[model samples]
Target: MNIMSPPPRKLGRIHVPAVTLAHGGGGKAMKDLIDDVFVSAFATDTPRALEDQARFDLAALAAHGDRLAFTTDSFVVDPLFFPGGDIGKLAVFGTVNDLAVGGAKPLYLSCAVVIEEGLKIEELRRVAQSMAAAARRAGVTIVTGDTKVVQRGACDKLFITTTGVGVIPAGVELAIGGIRPGDGILVNGLLGDHGAAILAARGDLALETEIESDCAPLHGLIDAVLKAAPATRTIRDATRGGIATVLNEMAEASGVAIEIDEAATPLREEVRGFCEILGLDPLYLANEGKIVLAVPPAEIQAALAAMRAHPLGACAMLVGHAHAGEQGRVTIQTAFGGKRIVDMLVGEQLPRIC
Candidate 1:
């Protein structure tokens, strides 16, 4: 005779004030923490049943595109909370942007977080909620995840690793090597906001200003650009190494020289002042919500207009162009009408700014 398995047990809620080693012991405590903090927050998008892996309909994914895009990133920012975002929000958008830059429609993500033993349960809950909110804004789902609690001092308060899966529609090919001479380079908005904000938030500089991290999801803006400028060559988010690094990589990949106008590059007054005070070059600073794109000269106007129409690209500017010169070289035309080479970053500018 066949026998049926018992129904799944109801999820349990955690009553503890802080996490402990027992919560990672793979017992009731661990279940409680996951149920109370993670599952509940992601309930709307994820399956109710707790499975080892998330399953998706192949046909459903195929309907969106002809190819799949996968990307993963980890967030270990020193301060879990920041001026405009926290580690959780950063984890979601960071991975989403990675896939979006590849000309994909981000659909699903897997979040794995390592929590310190003494972290407050309330703080963990807040982070979980933030991830959920970010996923909603990006039109993606946190389908599955893992949580592990470690002893105090073994890890930071929390670190999140997110892996994303997306669909790249047919005829949407974007690559670094696709950049060509005479291509127009464009950027969404001001640079160095994220790097400057993190520096000021640390309180070590004794400097104060109203600068907030430009941490945001850019898939919507990207979609708009592609629709308008179908012949766009390449795109990259100016994250850790900023626009200077991105430009250099593009130049190297396409075997072309890129020249950017310093006056044409957008920079907020606060960020400029922060860089000047710290003796930092804003060009090499970090940004979380900015993108640098190369568009064919024929479609440059259409691309710029489409970007400016989007909320995220209202301040978008065509900062430079790609041309034939020294292979893999990037230069900047200063506001004072002088030119200089823009080299790759030598070392970490601001550790843990992302």
Candidate 2:
């Protein structure tokens, strides 16, 4: 007589309305929470086994590139939900963008969440579903994750940490040190939208304006730039410190002076107004879906064209150029026919921004 193996175990389910200490007790309750919230949301072809790790085909990964790019970031933005994106979406794109800026093709992500006790189960489910949707949009997979519940007040309502892995294609190498004098500086789109949106979402200022966060995955836009201008020098995402920070970093790293035309910098009217009223510089404000890059003057046009061709880069513009001067100095040519130094931020203008 032939013998048969036992069937695979089914994923557990949650019955509680809100998370509790029992869910983090490493028993049936914990398993149920993971299965119902994360597994169900990030479900894919792989078997939902209670394995300690996720696996991938080595050969398949090798096909995309010669080197691996790995990055991790934690999101603790105030207001779990916000205009244009939420903490979950920010977590996914934030990690994905980190890999993309390094010339990597983002592939997989590992999501870990710390949920405070008493958070509604529905809220947790919503975040998980958001992450799944963002991963799909970025053409990546949520391969593995962990969940934890902390006592009330021990943590925020929710915090998400996503670790990403991508493959950097062969023949592609980018670094800030590659920047040279006369290289043209470029940015993908309007600045400070994310910062302004977050401020408005907080309701602390009692200021109101229609500005949405510019959170987005940028691998596609970066790939287009590379294909169009093979000689592009480097790219850096303008995140917490925004484009001003990125430019200062590139200048310091490459030992070059950089100057930008304030008139050329793109800004949504709402964001510009928001910054003016709050006495904040748009250049120093945070952005989630913007990039600062240097392209050889010879290929600037091509790079600009490629960037403008993509939806994310529709407002791409050449804002500055590196030149020989006081090394690591960055200045902006004011729209009013004056110039001033653009220095690194002393402290965060907006705390808990992302």
Candidate 3:
């Protein structure tokens, strides 16, 4: 017996490889890219929701020590560099915040390094060393890692993937769900500082200011807040999508309405002016170090005091509350006293700004 051969289409001239907008678009090309390259190496039992986040079990960590908390994030800022943070510092802080906001004491990280060919060895050393310093500052260890070198231009200078492991005490039953009507909403510090700082570093627009990325590990500050009020239900550090998107998502997930007081939202005088001129909303911009807290009414004052005592949270302020009405939506009482919707950003407002 013999098998018939299938006809073959002639192969087209080799497609010159380049990074393009389509690679980041959540479409056919993006899926193909992830499947062909990234995901195969990082596959897990978890569903690949491809969301800004994913959820997993933390109960197992209770047996290990206390409560289990696990999370992963990857950083791909355009320059592999930025003001106040390179891809390295951002990598560390990103993982740290994820674990801390989940009510875990971040203990370690599994770092995966992908370095493209022709990357400066000095810069590479700097990145690694900076990561070491950052992890140490956060009291975390880089317990294990893998490194890969792709052909030059296959990646943007460098990309870092960090998966973190931590343990929240079992007594802490924090949930984004705990946000309730009349509860206080607060931010640890200023908004838009991190986003604006990175934008200025890009040198795209000539607007000049002393802005800098608010990239910092929040483990200590988070601990401070939790100690004062273990009843603090939900906490998230505004990162890629900014405070606006974060609040919207939190409200939707928790089935509550988040109403923020714009006049109470903290912003540096210069930051506000910059946003007005650039046609940017400070709320829609990214932040690296700040946290948004949903806490009990009685604990509001205590939470704010704990946050402000920390260097990283010196400007903590109450901004809003989760309310009974307007199910799963976020509204801000504008500084003008008018109400407007605050929704998840439809697209990246300031890409590469974090």
- Number of clashing pairs, model 2? 0
Off by over 4 Å in 3: 1-64
Q: Report the C-alpha lDDT of model 3 over 1-354, residue by residue, as the tens digit.
A: 996645432221212254334544546654554443433333332324343343434554455456568899988887667778888889988999999898888877877767676665557656777787788788887655655667767887788899998888667777877788888998999998888888777777676556778899998898899999778989988988889988987888788998998999999887899889889989988899988989989999999999889998899999998988888888999978799988789987887654
lDDT of 2 by residue, 117-236 (tens): 999999989999999999999999998888889999999899899999999999998998999999999999999999988989987776655679999999999999999998999999
Supply candidate 1's per-residue lDDT for 56.
98
How close to the true structure is residue 29 of candidate 3, measured as C-alpha lDDT?
A: 51
| Cα lDDT listed for each candidate | 0.93, 0.93, 0.78
Clashes of 3: 1
Candidate 1: residue pairs that collide: none
lDDT of 1 by residue, 1-354 (tens): 987655655778998899999999999899999999999898773325588999999999999999999999989897888889888898999999999999999999999999999999999999999999999999999999998999999998998999999999999999999999999999999999988888878777765566888999999999999999999999999999899999999999999999999999999998888888789999999898999999999999999999999999999999999999999999999988899999999899999877
Give candidate 1 regions above 4 Å deviation: 1-9, 45-47, 206-208
Could you tell me the lDDT of residue 299 within candidate 1?
98
- Candidate 2, residue 27: the lDDT equals 93
